[model samples]
Target: MHSFSIILLPLLSLLPSTISQTSGTFNAMTFNVAGLPAILNDNGVPGDKTANTARIGQLFTQYNISLIQVQEDFNYHATLYANDKHPYRTATSGGVPFGSGLNTLSNYEFTDFARVKWNTCSNIDSADCLTPKGFTFMRVKFAEGVSIDAYNLHADAGTTAADTTARASNLRQVSDYITAHSINNSVLVFGDSNSRYTRTGDIPSIFSTANGMKDAWLELVRGGVAPQAGTDALLCDNPSPNTTCETVDKMWYRGSSAVELQAQKFQYAGNMFLQENGDVLSDHDPVLVDFAWTKV
Candidate 1:
């Protein structure tokens, strides 16, 4: 009995630290609020900006989503709606009033914040031309000497060749920024990418290879099914039998070898943001992902 106990104790001590303690868990979401000034009164899709803003706050409370990346948040929505709610925030629209439409809100205090406007955009798409689309970088300190870099972006939206090219360029800029700025390679890029894993382009490939990041939805939902990617949880509006869903809003993460990142759960929070009359809060559904981090 003494000999057996000695051998078992040594084997147990050899187990990885992940088997003993978990660092923490946090939830992240990427939502395109579609809070543009022109679309605020356009029926139930956009809904009333004020009411929709309230619903957005409700979503944060209901889900306890700690980190959020919002796109198309114009008209001081980031300041009026998010600043008071998130506590930690960064927002910019390229110095234009209601222009860039990118913001990052976090439960943790931000150590650093910056915005990078795209050098080029789709000339054919008037919407893209009017709005100054770009990516925002945020550094949040979770603990002493522990931080994560987050990049929020909203790429050009369209299926045309010019639009696709612009999207690829946007992705490249993001990748380059990550390469240059991300400390310890622990980073997350989330927002309305307008590019999918199934699409044929450098956007997906650049992230998979250059950034060493995995799509949170694909990595967690499909049971780690390599090369398989799809997000049909919810589309622009409420869930319907005839509604066709696609993967547009997404989250990607990369963790160092010392820190193991696992996706505990992923869901579409469109239902939570719906009005009592069944109207959606925004034109784009929010993608929420819960992640568990452990020291390896």
Candidate 2:
């Protein structure tokens, strides 16, 4: 009996960590709260920018989202933070003309936080380049001894050739950063990408083909088939997510050799973010992804 037990001990070490002990799931959201000053943001989207951002803060706790990454948090920084309740969060850089307009709120502790401004931007939009405008990278301690890199960004916006070129540069910059800094690390990249699968010149394959990251929307909601790269109608008037319809807000994730991260659910969660009058809190939808993790 002792001889049989000895042989079994080594074999058990080859198995994955006990699922009940170490595996779990979490929900992460990416939202671009239209937070420009009232005059500048007026007529762009429905609802008061101030009121919408303030309420946007409250929904985080109400929905019990495990973590969040927000963009366009420029003018209404204080208004939104006043109502938010995340114990772990990044301080606002400041208002635009000075701030990058990016922030993160998480249930998990994170470290090595850093921000990088885009090397390029197109003046076609004018407003997109008003801020530092780029992405933030950090190492989030997801669970005891389980760490994953998380990134939040607001890329260049517009549809002109110059705009698309700048946006492509933005995408590649993030991809290069991941390649250099997060090699072989589990990572989650989300925010207002402003790049769509069906949009020409938006180069969405950098994440999948270059970094091996999986798009939550494509994997969970679109049956793993990426929409063909070309221009298509984007119908985002409703809260219900359509298989064919993709939004600018995107979430990309990848698991390392030690930990396997898989997204079980991906959704356009705008219903809970609407004002009492039914106007949306922001022009872009708040995308939520539920991820499950286990040792590989």
lDDT of 2 by residue, 91-169 (tens): 9898868999899988888999999999999889656778899999999887767889999989999999989999999
Best by TM-score: 2
The reply for model 1, stretches above 4 Å from the true place, is: 1-22, 39-46, 76-84, 91-98, 225-245
For residues 1-296, write the lDDT of model 1, one tens digit per residue.
Answer: 99999999989877864354448888888988766675433424645676777677666766667888888777637433542467776745532344688877778887668878887688675367676788888887665445678898988887678888999999999998998898465788889898865555526657768888887776766554434344334343344222134457888898876676767787777776677787787777788788777665
Judge candidate 2 against the unseen true structure and give its global Cα lDDT, from 0 to 1. 0.86
Clashing pairs in model 2?
A: none
Off by over 4 Å in 2: 1-21, 238-243
Q: After best superposition, candidate 1 residue 157: deviation in angstroms? A: 0.8
Highest lDDT among the candidates is held by which one? 2
TM-score of 2: 0.90
Alpha-carbon error at 51 in model 2, in Å? Answer: 1.8
